[model samples]
Target: MEIAPGIYSMTQRKGAYVHAFLLDDGDGLTLVDTLYDTDAHRVLAELDQIGKSVSDIKHIVMTHCHRSHLGGLALLKERSGAPVYAHQWEADLIAGERKQQPVAWRPYAPVRVWPLQIALNLGVARHPPATVDHFVQEGDQVGPLRVVACPGHSPGHLSFWWEQRRLLIAGDAICTWPSLMLGWRGFTLNPTQHRASVRRLAEFDSQILCVGHGEPLASDAAQAIRAALPSLDR
Candidate 1:
């Protein structure tokens, strides 16, 4: 999905399913989030479909430090030698300065427990231990993308915004999947912070929302977020 002229959403096929975005900045590509190791080959395949090779990726901006989001970083970095950018807080966790925690809003059903844990242990549900090359604060500019600090899901969680196109690449700040109404379960540092971040994002007049899960929204993204707010409490 095209969040703007050069941005494209690259969804990974996983049990929970995750998405990453690609930004073709006229010169090269900037990847927003790299899927898990299990999905690394798929990400490479997708890149091939777009006429890009792994080596063509110049930079990678991580939305947060989650296994599903940063699992393939080591492999991708080895292939492309691209620099990884992340918020300072997340950078700490990714770099082993802090211990990673589980998400808070997991579904109550018992069916997913063991399998989820297995995936986590196998490095398919969380990021493989690694380091970031660049630590970003709230207002950092990544090529043409602007980093919007949206912490709540994690201390350093962030979203990317393209002011020129009114596009927002919301990582897990908001998910499009209705099944994850309460927000992504398994590991969330703070629910209250996450909600506040969502509200903050709603204030932005973005025309497109390319979230981490579910379908992408075109135009009136703020309205869609408003409509989803009520269900978040369910």
Candidate 2:
């Protein structure tokens, strides 16, 4: 689905309707995440439908190293030969040098995620490891995105802002799945950091919002994010 001009949102049933975005800034395609398929068939289909090929994917950017988002990283990187960019904190994990830091096993408000939390704690269902070619920090530009370091979901969690389009690519910092939320409580490593991150995300005058999970918010995106701010307190 084209959530906005030049931005296409791709979703998968696995990983709680996990989403990835394909961005065309005219230079070439820049993929936000790879979705929840190891073969990357879904993403490839989307590209084919748009008459684009893997080589057109000039940059592949990662929001974090979570398994749900990393499934197609290796395949896409190998096919597109695009340099992968992520935060420094997630480099080792992305490279398979270390497993992701686990989250609490206890059930939180969105109990549906408990199973996933348990899977992470047990280090099960790992994704194919891929190398990160570059480490991006806040203010750094990757394609048309301005990297925003929004930790708390994990130490190196990131979000992206496209000032040109007033778009915010909020990874797990905010979720619209099950319902709009300030990230899943059970998986949140640091509530304080997540809270601050959401607060900062809400400040963006985003007219469109794309998240790590759930459908893209096409309108009143900033207003919706601000409205969900009180959830951070709970």
Candidate 3:
């Protein structure tokens, strides 16, 4: 789905479904997050749907360091030769400085049964660490998008917000699902920090909320976030 004029959300299936945004900056396309390695072909196929090729992806921006988010980095780098951009703190994880942690979920979570969930957590033990071509801090600009630091899911988690366009690419800062569901079931490095990140996002006036795991919220996104604030406090 085209979220804006040149921005598109490529929804892909892994353990659970996930969405990665594609932004065309006229020079080349910028991929928000790379899908899982196993789903690379599917992702490439989806890119084809928009008349884009893997080689057309000039920059790979990671929202965080989760394997599900960076699993396809090696393959994408092999194909696109694009510089991978990530937060300085996450650069080590992305570059193999720190070991990628195992994915663990509460036994009562909804997606444990899915084979990909186990595979992603256990099967892919190590991610191919790559160097960051560009390290971004909060308030930096990537093309026309502004970088916003919202670290809670990971120490270096970041989101891209296009203030002029009222577009926000929130990387798991907040999800369409309930906070408890995400805390107990979804992937999070730190729940306390995540809550803070959510609160920080509320301060920004955004028209769209593009999360890593659900459909994009196009209407009253800021209000929706305000309503979800109480849940985070609990």
Candidate 4:
């Protein structure tokens, strides 16, 4: 779906949860958060939905190195030849130099659902190891995008800013699939940082929220996030 003028959000099931997004910066197609390799072709299909193709991808940015996000890297790189960019801390993880980080369990998780979310992330949220070509830090400018460091989901988790569109490309930093909510507690490394990340993201006051899952919030997006912050961990 079109999140704003030049941005789009696409969801491919990695069983039950986890998501990826695609951004068009008026120059070429840039993919953010690619689902598992199992869903690799889905990118080609999704691109086709917009009358684009794999070769059109000029750069691929993985929000973090989680397997769920890296799953499609190999094939996408093979086909598109676009450089994969990620945070410096996540570079090794993406390159298969380190083991994936495990989610921490928390009792007061914002969402109190049953084993469904767990089953999906553990059993289905997986992808092959891949390499990264670029390592980015906070305040980096990528085409029309501005890299915003919003960690805690992962040590180097990032969200992108489309200044002109007033849109936030929220990675696992926030999700809106079920409802306006913080990142799933289990997957987040630090609830405090995650909450802080949300707060930092809120400062942008973006009008469109292109989140990690569910549908994108097309309007008053920043208010929606700030509105939810009070309930998160203090």
Could you estimate the TM-score for every candidate?
Answer: 0.84, 0.98, 0.83, 0.88
lDDT of each: 0.73, 0.92, 0.73, 0.76
Candidate 2 lDDT over 30-74, as tens digits, reads 999898889999999999989999999999999998889999999
lDDT per residue, candidate 1, 1-234, as tens digits? 565577777665563567887888787888888775544776787788888898889888889877667777777877889998998878877765665664433354233433654455454334556678999978899876899998877888889898887888888877766443435644446777877777788788888888776667877887777767775455
lDDT of 4 by residue, 1-234 (tens): 665566766666642355667778778988887776554877778889888889888888878876656777888887899998899899887777776665643343445432534543454444566688888878987666789999898889989998888878888888775676777776778777888888889899699887776678889987888888876764
Q: Evaluate candidate 2 by giving its C-alpha RMSD to the native, one decimal.
A: 0.7
**Model 3: per-residue lDDT, tens digit, 72-98?**
777887788998888988888887787
Error of 1 at 147 (Å): 0.9
As for TM-score, the candidate ahead, 2 or 4, is: 2
| Candidate 2 off by > 4 Å | none
* Model 2: how far residue 153 lies from native, Å: 0.5
Best by TM-score: 2
Query: Regarding lDDT, does 1 or 2 come out ahead?
Result: 2
> How many clashing residue pairs appear in each of the predictions shown?
11, 0, 0, 1
RMSD of each: 3.2, 0.7, 3.1, 2.6
TM-score of 2: 0.98
